[model samples]
Target: MSLSETQPDAAGARRIARPVPLRESVYSAILDMIVSRNLQPGQHLVESELALMLGVSRQPVREALQWLKNDGWVDLRPGLGAYVHTPTVEEADQLLAVRRLLETESARLAAQHATEEGVEHLRELCRQGFAALEAEDVATMVALNAELHATVMRLSRNDVLVELASQVDRRVRWYYTPVARHRGAQSWTEHSALIDAIAAGDGDRAGEVMHAHTEHTRLSYLEQQNLEKSGADAGSPARPITGRRP
Candidate 1:
């Protein structure tokens, strides 16, 4: 199943499941495109075109666009339809900082609770990440990066932490996508150190490694912004959020 139904219902049925709703799947598809940069930032989202592309009708596209707007992923202009939201530096920094805090704690806890199987899993993921990096497969690298972090969070064995991570994980993927290739080899190297710390059951070392790794990603993004600013000379300014509509 695309969606995992791990929790039991009120009646306590085992692994109760349902097919993911079409609206949600469509929303995810559009969001993934945005995260992957397949749909460029600020590019207009035509409902009919999206419907045709995703093999869905216009209604789901319309609903998905609205949902994206509500979630700050897209903007629905009065007459101009929908467009992807271009993230600003301030926004990225804030979210990445939050990610660092949560993930650092997860790493610490994972080190304390690491099992043989979990450590092996982390190593397997690390190998795959290195392979992706070697093959110059940014998309697969990004996905595997997520999977590795998710595995660490799982090893933490904290349901609440996992849930919180899941909430921000999609946005993290969005922010990390640009920096994936930029941090490719170094990122995996950091992952190797983190895995070693976990395997050694050194909570402090694992926490420190994870914290540094995430901070590096954030700093790299800032460097990229600097390069972009220099390239643009007179960079098109980001639109400031306002209290009242123009």
Candidate 2:
């Protein structure tokens, strides 16, 4: 059944009652699909196919497309359907710069403000991420990594920083997914260090670690992209596809 139909009371009242709105679900689904490379960059999104895949009506998918367009995730055409937006190198650099600034501050604040419980939560998330990686569960690792970051952001207790970090985080995830598998354990090792810095209340160290971590991620993604392009230029059609990092 469709999400709207599943919420009989809300559907009857013509309202959404969940913590996450229907539009947000649609938006997230589309974003995940794109990030996971199920929908390739510059690939067209057929409305009917999306509706069927998402188990919703065309309305929500259309609404999601509009939201994605505003976020620069998709481009809407007059005659054709929506297409995944391919970010330029300059755009990627801009996003990484903003992300590094926001996340470094978040890590610093989290070091100062994180409670014991918050630290424990982050540890659990890190453990889960490691386990996911060991199991080759790339999707789970991606989700757990997001949870770890979200936990740290919440520990900072700064709403403005949280919001800004979330925006940059999403964009980074979009770029990271296609190249995550290449870097593998190195990513998780950095995450562990960030958690350790926060646990020790080392604000400056936390910030520095986070900055390096994000910078490394950005560089790795660019390198992978360049490697792929070179392979294509060399007419190597048998290059292996790498999974994205968590």
CA-lDDT, candidates in order: 0.89, 0.84
Clash pairs of candidate 2? 180-244, 180-245, 181-243, 181-244
Residues 165-223, candidate 2: write the lDDT tens digits. Answer: 87677777777776566556888899999999999999999999999988988898788
Task: Report the C-alpha lDDT of model 1 over 10-57, residue by residue, as the tens digit.
Answer: 346555698999999999999888877788677899999999999999
Every model: Cα RMSD to truth = 8.0, 7.0
Model 2 TM-score is 0.81
Q: What are the clash counts of all predictions, listed in order?
A: 0, 4
Question: Which is the leading candidate under lDDT?
Answer: 1
User: Residue pairs in steric clash, candidate 1?
Assistant: none
